[model samples]
Structure formats: C-alpha cells, structure tokens
Target chain A: MTRPNLQVALDHSDLPSAIKDVTNVGDIVDIIEVGTILILQAGDQAVKCIRAMYPDKKIVADTKCADAGGTVAENVQKAGADWTTVICCATIPTMKAAAEKIEEVQVELYGDWTYEQAQLWLDAGISQVIYHQSRDALFAGETWGEKDLTKVQKLIDMGFRVSVTGGLDVETLKLFKGMPVYTFITGRGITAAENPAQAATDFLAEIKRIWGE
Target chain B: MTRPNLQVALDHSDLPSAIKDVTNVGDIVDIIEVGTILILQAGDQAVKCIRAMYPDKKIVADTKCADAGGTVAENVQKAGADWTTVICCATIPTMKAAAEKIEEVQVELYGDWTYEQAQLWLDAGISQVIYHQSRDALFAGETWGEKDLTKVQKLIDMGFRVSVTGGLDVETLKLFKGMPVYTFITGRGITAAENPAQAATDFLAEIKRIWGE
Candidate 1:
C-alpha cells in the first residue's frame, strides 16, 4: 500500500496569514490546500500567489463546487490547481463536466462525500473521496470516534483513495497511524503553532514513523 | 406583489473582466453576484473589490459553501457579502452554524436546494432558495423546462424568497413573467454582450415592463 502524504490546509481568512504560514511549512508539506474559507475570502489571487511561490508543489483548490461545474473546473485548473474538490451533491452534469475538465487539464477531482452520499462518486465516475470530519460537530461535543476510523478502512476497502480532514492535531493523528488514507489534511494543527515549520516537520516525521514511508 | 430585482452575475474567469463588466452595469443592477466561477477563480478578493466599489449595492459572495459553514459565513459577510449561499446538501450542523452566523452579521443565507431537498431551508431557518438550472443539462439537450417553472411556484407557495439562475437570456426571461421570483440572476445574459451596459439596461427595462416594478 502506498503511504499517504501530509497536505497542509491553509484555511486562514487573510491572504498574508496563509502565505506566511505556508512559507513556514512548505518544505515539509506535500500538498498545499487553499481551503474553502480562503478561496471564498481571498479568491484566485491566493491561487496565483501560492502557485507563483511554489512552482513544483502540488496545490488543491478546494472549491467544494456544487454547481457550474465545467466553468469552475476549467478556470481553477487554468489558475494553477493540481486538484479541485467538488461537493458531494453536484449534479451529474456538473460531475461529468468536472471529470472531463480534470482529464483535459491533467489534474484531478475529489468529491467531499458523506456516508449517505457515498454513491455519488460512482455516479460521477470519480474514485477519489474526502471523508470529512465536520468541525461544527467537533465543536458541538463530538470527538473523532471509532466510526470515523472504521469508515476510513471501509472506504479504503471499497477501493477509494480516501482523504481525511477536520482540525487534526498530533494527538488526534495517532488514531490513524496505520490507516490507508491517501492524504492527511491539517489546518490549524500546524498553522496555529508558534513555529509552523517545526510543527509541520514533526507531523512529517510522525507520518513517516507510523507508516514507514 | 413584490417586484424582482435585476442581479448581474459576474461569471468571468478573470478578475479584470468581471470588474469591468460589473462597473458598466453597476448603476442599474440591484445585486452584484460574485458567481461561482469568479469566486473559485478570484477568491474573496472579487467580493472585496466589488464591495469596495459599490458600498451600497447588495453583494452575494456565492461561496456555495458546502462545509465549514460557520467559518465561511462569518468571514465572507465580514469580507462584505450581503448574502452567502450554502449548498442544499450541507449537514444540519453546517446549516445551523451558517444560519446563526448570517443572522449575527445581519446578512442573508440562500440554500440551493433541488426539488426533493426543498424543505432543507425551512429546516435550516433560511427563507431564500435558488432553483438553479444546470448548464450540463442544457448542453445535453435538456432545456430548463416546465418542471423548473413549477418548482419555482412551489417554492414561492411554500413561502421561500426564491431566486433563479442558469443561462438566463432575454428570451428566457420573458418566460418567467408574472412569476413570484425574488431575484433574477443574469451572467452572460449581460456580461457576454458586445454592449454589456445596454444589455443590462435592457434587462432592467424588461423586468420593469414584465413585473411592473
């Protein structure tokens, strides 16, 4: 099994904060996700800035695109995204257009699918999936529980290149040490740290230690 | 009967094109929508720029936020969106958080619910809905047919502040006359024309002629 990469999520509402933190962790991070909050707040200028700064790094424009699939997919990829995320509920037409656009651009598309919406990937003919842990749920008295781990295993068993995210920290990451997630996404986990570089380096080390990458 | 407002959607892939087109029609447009393509390609900078230019006009961030609802709602509104849209499939937790944030900021939330998902807005305590016409369907030889119009009437009867969008041109706008649409969103309908100002003015005039605004 191929080990997953550490994708640092820059969810900062401000462009400078995200750029400052991304510069700190860029050496250790494998994928840089310009998160939905940043995308909605900063726009493609963020994509341009990040793309210019890291020409070789893989970047994900997490648009959570629910509509206007073709136009968004074509343009975001043109703006220099290696991957773009579509929401779980996109229309079949949107999904089909997105898949075609991704292929044409030599990029990839992942759907943010919930348990009930798992079938959407099959319908969309896209295999990559992000099994998100809701931050609202986390703040509303729920912890990342056993079901989430099992869900990850289930998605892997079902032949998905699964990605997991939700306010992940070092302490919480121990739970998925040997799991077959294709990507481990961290946001405030590294960005909020005093020394983001040290924090990201530690995360990389931990991933390597756990998965023997 | 409340008259519908002319909302010019800036769906351009480049920020400069959107800015220029919006500037041409700004005086007549009641709402300036940072369309999905603009939002994904330009990020929140699009919203900030338009907001700075038209401090009095209503701006829809059109994040189409499907997850991390609270953070997106609070920040986009703070970034100067008069309204933020959430995908119909967002989790209850996301909806709850978004509703609270929009209310706290004294803005609005519109849910893009499909036919079956119409009740989600009521469940989320949001009154606005968008009966989106999928472009994929249009390309696939599926026109925005009668079922879509009926669905609009259904939503209005159900007491929703309904908005309709998707490749709306003047010919198509004539079809929705006397309907209870709260807002009519036009992107290429105005921006794609050789004379975008004349196109937008025509749309505004037609709206008044049809709805007696």
Candidate 2:
C-alpha cells in the first residue's frame, strides 16, 4: 500500500500570515492546500505566490467550485495551481466542463458525500475526493471515531484518492491507521500552533509511525 | 414600484480586460459585480482595482460563499467590496457569520425555491435574493412564454431586494415588466457584445423605458 501524504491546509484569513506559517513548515508538508478561505481571501494570487515561494511543491487551490467549472479550472491553472477543487453537488454540465479542463490541470471534488454522490463523481471522471469530518460535532465533545475509517475505506475501494480533513489533530491521527488515504489535511492544528514547525514535525512523525515510512 | 438597477457583471478571465470594459460603461451601470470567475482568477486585487477605478460605484464581490462566512466576508470587505454573496444552500451559521461582518455588505442568495425559501431568508436577516433563469433553455429556442411574475412579486412583498439573471436580453427584458425586480444582472448580453458600452447603454435605455425612470 502507498503511504499517505501530508497536506497542510492554509485556511487563514490573510496571505502573509498563511505564507509565514507555510514557510516555517514547508519542508515536512508534501502538498500545500490554499484552502477555501485562502482562495476567497486572496484569490488566484495566493496560489501564484505560494507556487513562486515553493517552486517544486504541489499546490492545490481549494475552490469548492459549484458552477462555471471550466472558467474556474482555467483560471486556477493560469495562477500556477497544480490542482483545483470542485464541489460534488455541481451540475453535470459544470462537471463535464471541469473534467475537460482537467486534461490541462488536476480537478478534485471537495465535499462529504453519500455512496451515491461518490458513485456519481466517479462516473463524472473525478479521481480525487475530499472527505470533510464536520467541525461542529468534533468541537462539541465528539470523538473522531469509527464512521470516518469506514467511509475512507469505502471511497478507497471505489478507486478514489481520498483526502481527509476537518479539525485533525494528533489524537485523531491514530484513528486513520491502515487507511488508504491519499493525503491528510489539517489547518488550525499547524497554523494555530505556538510552534508551527514542531507541530508539522509532530504530524510527520505520527504519519511515519502509522505507515512505517 | 422601484426602478430595477442595472448591474453589469464582469466575469472576465483577466483584470485588465474587465477594468477596460467597466471603465467604458461605468457611468450607466448601477452595481458593478466582480463576478465569481473574476474574483477567483485575480483574487481580491480585482475587487480593489474596480473599487479604485470606480470609487462611487457599488462594488459587489460575488464570492458565492459556501462555508466559513465570516472569513470570506472579512477578506472581501478588506478588498473593498460593498456587498458579498452567500449561497442559499449554505448553513445558517455561515449566513449569520457573513451578516455579522459588516452592515454595508449585503448577502445575496442564488437558487430555485418556493416562497418558503424567501420567508426563511427574510427571517434569517438576508436582504438580497437571486432568481436564476436557465441559460440552456433560453439559448435553445425557448422564450419567456411561460413566465411567472407572481414569484417575483411575492419575494418583493416579503421585503427582499431581488435580482433577476440568466441570459437576460431585450426580448426577455419585456417579460419582466411590472415585476418587482431590484436589479437586472447581465453578463454575456453586455460583456460579450461587439460594442460593450453601447450594449450597456441599450440595456439601461430599455430598463428606463420599462420602469419610466
């Protein structure tokens, strides 16, 4: 089994702060996600700036695009994003347009999905899926429990490169053992930490321990 | 009944072209929408440029925010947008977070809904509603023959600022007469025209004739 990658989600309100944090921990992170908030806050320039700063690192623009897929895909590609995300709920025409553009750039779907939505996305030729673990439940004394592992396995079985996200921390990382995840994405866990580099190093250590990398 | 404002939606893929077009017809356009494509393409720089170029115009960032409303609102507001859009399908928390950001930033919802959704938005403190017409049907030899003005009237009666969009042209503009529309948002009808300024002027003239402004 391929080892899962670590993607630091830069979902901050400002580009300078996000860049500063990424600069501190870019060495440990495999993929850098310009999260939805970052994309909305700074637009494509955020992607461009990050791409310039880390010339070889993979940068994914978390657009969460629901409509006008071709336009969004083309724009992000021009901004130096290696991958752009579309919402699973987007219309078929929009998906088709996005897929066509994906020939030139990578397109991933970002949303929690039922079995049917996952099947539909596969049918639409989307290979990447972002599975969000709801923050509300996590913050309200709920644990990162069994439900996610099952969902992750199901999506992996369906031939998707699944990315897991939502309030991920050291405790929750243990729950993902033996899961065929493509990338593990965490936001506040790293950016909000007192020592971002150490936090990233901790996350990398945990991943290596889980996967024996 | 209030005269419908003429909103020119700049959905261009580049800032220079969008700025050029807006400057050409900025005097006649009531609301300048830095469309989703433009925002995603150029980032908040697009909003800042438009606001700087057209200081008196009401600049709207069509962020189409799906989640994390406060972050999206603050970023765009920092970019100098007068209003920001939230997807109608967004959770209540997202909407409330957007509303809490700034009094000047109006939240616009887009979706096909019964009157119940309008009431829900009103109760939720959303002041703007977007009504979408199908562009495919409009372009495929279909007319506004089976028009429904009652929905627009109903939304207006509920005290929402309603905007009508989707391939809006002179032929279709006639059907909206007597409907309580707050704004008519035109994209391709103006932006794709051979002479965009003239096209904007013609649209404004038709709107004046209909509303006797």
TM-score of chain A of 1: 0.90
lDDT of 1 at B153: 89
Count of backbone clashes, every candidate in sequence? 7, 1
Runs in model 1 deviating more than 4 A are A103-120, A123-125, B103-117
List, in the given order, the native-contact fraction of each candidate.
0.61, 0.35
Best by TM-score: 1
Q: Which stretches of candidate 2 lie over 4 Å from their true place?
A: A103-115, A133-159, B104-120, B133-159
Each candidate's DockQ: 0.48, 0.35
- How displaced is residue B45 in candidate 2, in Å? 2.2
**lDDT against the true structure, each candidate:** 0.76, 0.76
- Candidate 2 CAPRI grade: acceptable
Rate residue A22 of model 2 by lDDT: 92
Model 2 lDDT, residue B116, Cα:
68
Tens-place lDDT per residue, model 2, B27-46, is: 88899999888888777889
Which model scores highest in DockQ?
1
Query: Can you write out model 1's per-residue Cα lDDT over B10-71, one digit (the tens) per residue?
Result: 87887898988888998888999888788777776788899999999988877777667788
Which 10-residue window of candidate 1 chain B scores lowest in summed lDDT? B103-112
